[model samples]
Target chain A: MEKKKEMVKTKRAQKKDNKWTQNDKVFLYILIPILILFFVFNTLQLLKGFYYGLTNYKGYGDYSFVGLRNFIDLFSDARVGKSYVFTFKYAIVLTIIVNIISLILALGLNKEIKGKSVLRGIYFVPNILGGLVVGYIFSFIFTYILPAIGQMAGITFLQNSILASTKSAWIAIVIVGAWQGIAMNTIIYISGLQTVPEDVYEAGMIDGATGWEKFCKLTFPLILPFITINLVLCMKNALMVFDQIMSLTKGGPSQSTESISYLIYNNGMSGGQFGFQSANAFVFFVVIVIVSFLQMKFLGGKEEQL
Target chain B: MSENMEKVTKEAVEGAVTNENEGEAFAKKRRAKHKKQSGPVQGKTVNRVINILLALGCLTVLFPLYMTTIIAFKQPSEMTNDISGALGFPAEWKFENFTEAMRVTDFWHSLGNSILITGVTVALCILIHSLAGYVIGRKMIKLKAFKMSYYYIVSGMFVPFAVLMMPLVKQTAQIGIANRFGVIVLYTVFFMPMNVMLYTGYLKNIPTQLEEAAHVDGATAWQTFWKIIFFNMKPMHATVAILTAMSTWNDVMTPLVIMAGTDENTLPLAQLNFQSQFGTNYNLAFASYLLALLPILIFYIVCQKQILSGVVNGAVK
Candidate 1:
């Protein structure tokens, strides 16, 4: 009779297992379709895109396996090289200017001041705008208003559209970029400021630390993680600047402001070199991946050390 | 003897109370000292200068947007002289500039397309991502292979759309969805991973006890998800919705590539074409920019509080 009872218990456990299997089945049926869709569109396409980098073709149709030929062409292509160089310069300048201005704004606004809330909203307005609109608006400013203002003030540098020249084009891009980018970074800095506890400041004061010393020792370390996050975000954005460049400068005055992203889009879609552009995209992606990895590692280590 | 003992005890209690008050006062004085040490030290002139500088910075930031507004309203003849300062209202305001912009862009049709595409994409993206997030965060954690897929999707965040544009264009065309609807599919596909990251991150923190209970009540998985889990994800829902909506509304490249030969055009694309077609007509171009900008501004104004709080909360965590 005891053996019979043991067998019966095993049967009941098996039945419970069967029930869970039934639920798993239902779950799989629900999930599989979405999974398939995601796979086919994103994962599958990503692999296929990488494959095109190894071949030679126009924007469509059959291609021969070229085996690093297109990748070789990427290094030799001066236009692509110029875009990469320009984008890097833009990113470095933007990251510094944006972080500084936003941090200053955060410091100023973090004080016990009146109208701080309203001022924050007003400051954040540019971020609410799409890049295209902001770009176009800034384009008009550069192409017309600034020139007119320059004429009025007798300033030689601003007599023509800054975007019309290679030297000034980058400066224009940086300005427009910072104009919009500062809002998000400022908000981020404010949030970061909020996280650094008030007691720490009191401690700094107790140590008789100067304002600059207190900031360097206390606030900066506390907000290091935020800086890292913002830096990475800023770098990525600066690197991928397409809309503003397209609208404001159109990568003009000799393709001086053409970013890698713009280069990929132009070459792949409109420039009629499918495999070559694909190779450019792959390299671009690899560079992005490496920089992103470095960013996380470099800052993540600092954050942990802090 | 009893009276003397009572008086001594009362005196002791009073002494303790006085000591405690003294200690509290000392702590308050210390706090005040810290404040006095760290508080602002700028003289009146310095303070005034800083405030003036900040105000000036605000004006400088506002310059381009201000120009867009004034230039949009000014007649063509006024453009040259009115460029002196960016702030003044036009003497002859061209309200018809908006009408002209609207006519040039085929505003109503493009607006309809944008609304349909963005709305449907946002809704579908939310549903699919939330469901996927729920499953991954809750159920799939136990299965190693399934957990790997979770990581895979998360890794997709690093790859920009430009990387896959080559194959993606062909793939969409192969399926014969290379138009307005195709653009929607791309948004849904590309925008999924971020929202999934968000939702899954959120759902991981939400305990499964309630869901388990719903399961115990003989509710099917579908019923339990709809009745209990989906409603509980309101904050994630809002973040995903607003983000997806904004990007879809503002997007130009995706539509430009997929629907280049097609008749369909979203507002941003329409605006771009309008600007080009009316090239050098600053008034109409400025007006077109404002018109493209108007809906977003209204959306911001309407949902300002929620958007701000939601964005801050979402990113902060």
Candidate 2:
């Protein structure tokens, strides 16, 4: 160890004397290709997306720069407005539902319960499965199995497929989304709950604090960061929800569930409203950045208080 | 009798004092026993309630999976409109549903495609991202350019893929890689920012002295990296590989848009394409979904402990 430390010191001295070393060459060789790829795929695509937003370009040959025409159309376009609304509504509702259920599960799992590991494993199964497949499975459940059970039980609401009606379709989507979404959040919250030292609870015990008080005053404050992460992640994912929507409803029943992402893909790639959708995509991008920023600012501040 | 009782009480008190001073473990055991004797009746009931509730929650979580499995095995004739039809087991478990699913979806072909895509993307991500991370992580403090580049790449985290979907569709075709290969390249790039962040953050703990020692031994930069740095990054590799593999395996959009006209199909895309054609023949659809799910499911079941912890580690970053 001593020899190695001495050697490191000597090497640093030699490196300071040399203007261009073998390491510099290695750095450039590695960095240049990565940067080139990044520029081509990521940077170029972003610029092209922004530029295309200004053009009258279809997916094909010729186009003229229309200069914010697509942006102008975006505001008045009822479909765009509807998608934005749906996305926000879905994001907000799912975020709250998912976090609550996950926190509850996490709290339960954190206790010295029997078969806790097994229970956790089962809850986490949904996270590993693909969203599209889960959506399809749930689609069948909603379409057939629930109605069958409802008919058998004589329950009026369940007798009909909830997905068939636009009013209740989003509810079905939310059910499936929450089922799958809570797994990761629960895992995260469990991890956060585990971080609370046993001695802190012992301290609470000395103060004669009830379970609920202990959680609100001690556990809640400690895990606020994890909560922040879960909320931000859930909200972000909900906004970009595509796979489940694709499999379940395809943004259907008169496009009531058309998320911003679904709208972009449906119109931009296949609908040949490429240029117009590009403008919408740009706006969606800005919204996400702002939402993330706001979440960080708000939640991060709350975290700092404790 | 009174004198004997006094002696017994004094000895018991002394024993308790000694246990407190020198036998923490013994004291803990005694306290545990005391608590159990006093409170176990109510505690047991509460535990039972929690257990029942959790069991129900587990049932809800597993319900879709159970339905999928049963429906996959059922014969088409058995798939009636009633609850019994959906719930009842098959008289003879039809393994051929899987075979038919494979045939309809070209299961081997798509499975091979999914594996190839995931395998190659994971390999490239580890190889390329680690190198970039090493360079940027080590040199960013000294070089202003590296610092700028770090921020530049990390900023891509905020850019949603939807924004780039249209332009990339056109761009990939124009570049003549509107196929699996192109998708592979794009996946490598798509995952760059996050993976780089993970790797660079990880590299902070790996000391520079190891590299200096290798340099003193006349080893080249590449040699040092291949021999020392790569192996040191095993934990991060597990995190990155699992994350990349899961996403690449399950992803539907990239293949949908990029591999549109191509004959190649990832598992999700194949299942999707066959979905409408199967229509009411859900036995076949369920079978295909199971088959698509089988590989990842097996992978998860095996490495679940590692995967779960890795997810927590990755999410924090």
Model 1 chain B weakest lDDT span, ten residues long: B1-10
Can you tell me the CAPRI class of model 2?
A: medium
**Segments of candidate 1 deviating more than 4 angstroms:** A1-25, A304-306, B1-52, B85-88
**Candidate 1 steric clashes:** 0
Reference contacts recovered by each candidate, as fractions?
0.49, 0.68
Question: What is the iRMSD in Å for candidate 1?
Answer: 3.7
Best by DockQ: 2
Where is model 2 more than 4 Å wrong at Cα? A1-22, A304-306, B1-44
Q: Summarize candidate 2's per-residue lDDT along A1-306 as a digit string, tens digits.
A: 788778778767887797556787688788888999998999899888999999988888899999989999999999999999999999999999999999999988877787788778878988988888888999999999999989989999999999999899999999999998999999999999888889988898789876689999999999999999999989988988999999999999999999999999998887889899999998888899899999998898888343
Determine the TM-score of chain B of model 1.
Answer: 0.82
DockQ, each predicted model: 0.38, 0.60
